[model samples]
Target: MACSGCYSVNFMAVSSNPNKPLTSSTLLTSKLSSSYSQIPFSSLNFNSKLSRIQLHKSNTAPNSFVVVSGIKAEPLKVMISGAPASGKGTQCELITKKYDLVHIAAGDLLRAEVAAGTENGRRAKECMEKGQLVPDEIVVTMVKERLSQPDSQEKGWLLDGYPRSSSQATALKGFGFEPHIFILLDVPEEILVERVVGRRLDPVTGKIYHLKYSPPETEEIAARLTQRFDDTEEKVKLRLLTHNKNVEAVLSMYEDVTVRVDGSLSKEDVYTKIDTVLRNVLGQRQAAIVLLVFPCDMFGISTA
Candidate 1:
């Protein structure tokens, strides 16, 4: 199904059990060699080929979105999937800075709307005050609008929320929005609860800090920092339960391409792992495209 809104030709995984190291096939190696053969073997080109081959042989490999020659690179659209308070916001902040990608946090958007007195915000705020989930249609419409923005066309985007169900995922697909990567942050329930309880927000700036990891200096000052009423232990548990259930269903739709990162690790460590995975995935896609374009010529096989 085509998206009913304006059509923009905006160009845009995983594993598990014991997490075995990914191995690329020898076929890819042979194809890569052939791909190089098709190009003029000047000294510069030779060195380039050697570097490319070595890069491809590293532990990293591409996930999807092969980069083809002469094809403009599309902005990467990524979905960060995890339970509430799973450090997703932290990771996104880092990623957007490093990669120049747009960050769209659905909760923030809805909150802003409520602050701005928008109709949708009014409706969503009412539901939130009552502890109800906002309707999926309202959420999806907001997402569509966000994605259609001018900045979204230029900079790649990280979607922080707003696909809480299988139906929303299906709707996104119909809208021609397929994420190149779906990252899941796996953290233990006990740790999550502790983190949630320790969290404090600066109501003036909305900056979040944790008493343990990122305390506000003095106890007097930190004590003044407000803890969200919603962040209470009982509420955190309930939210986590609901998040886990919904995430499980949403993840079922993306079994093959999902990459799970250990949120238990230090924030820097987690970011490093994710960055490595993304680079590998991007490189693999590039290699595939190069091989595809010069298949016969690269391998010394006559297709004519």
Candidate 2:
């Protein structure tokens, strides 16, 4: 069904299960090597052969949007998925620093709205205070407005902790900002629980530390450490269960574009695997299309 209001929405899903053969249309749409040969770029004097491409950056990070052969690269729209304490926050920070992409956490955006006392935020707060999930329309609307920001439109953005359900994913596509890639961090439940329950936050510097793996530097620092109320084991377990239920369905929707990483490895090792997947994706670069979809406040909700 099409979304109400000014937005028009269409969604496409790709199958990436290696054991099963893809259908005719799925094969055609897949970004695999076989499909690239079928692109009609050859008639335009463009190379059909995939080549290794390096990302170049200017002095300023935002100014470093990818440019290849005079064609500006499409903004990198990525969504990172993981269970609680799966190290998504750490990885996102690393990715943003390395690639200069805007990082938008769904929770943060919602929190900011509530803090600013917007109408949507008020509605969201009611549900949140009751420990209920926020409605998809509210979340999707806020996300649409966020992506319409100048920095997000130009430099590209990485989304974290949004679209946990298939419906939420569809709603995002309805907003015309479907992610180009999906990164899933697969960690054992045991490990995830341990990571979450053992986590500590520095009240002063705001740095995260694990009680066992990455404790404070000294006893003095440890004394100053504080754990969030939600860091308890019961909370972690409930959060994980909620995450598992929603993420399984969402992952299926992006099978072709999904990069599953084993999150049990060391932080650096996990990052290495993620970096490799990103490099491979960027290597098979598509012809660029710079879309200022929401420029000039052309798309969003009606205040009235």
TM-score of each: 0.70, 0.65
Prediction-by-prediction clash tally: 5, 0
- Give the runs in model 2 whose Cα sits over 4 Å from its true position: 1-71, 111-132, 218-220, 286-304
- Model 2: how far is 2 from its true place, Å? 50
Off by over 4 Å in 1: 1-69, 129-131, 217-224, 291-304
19-102, model 2: which lDDT tens digit per residue? 223334422121221121111122122233323222222122221112122233576888998987888989999999988999
Q: Whole-model lDDT, candidate 1?
A: 0.66
Compared with the true structure, model 2 gives a TM-score of: 0.65
Q: Give the alpha carbon lDDT tens digit for every residue of 195-223 in model 1.
A: 98889988766889998899886666666
Model 2 Cα shift for residue 212 (angstroms): 1.6
The lDDT for every candidate, in the order shown, is 0.66, 0.67
lDDT of 2 at 140: 83
Best by lDDT: 2
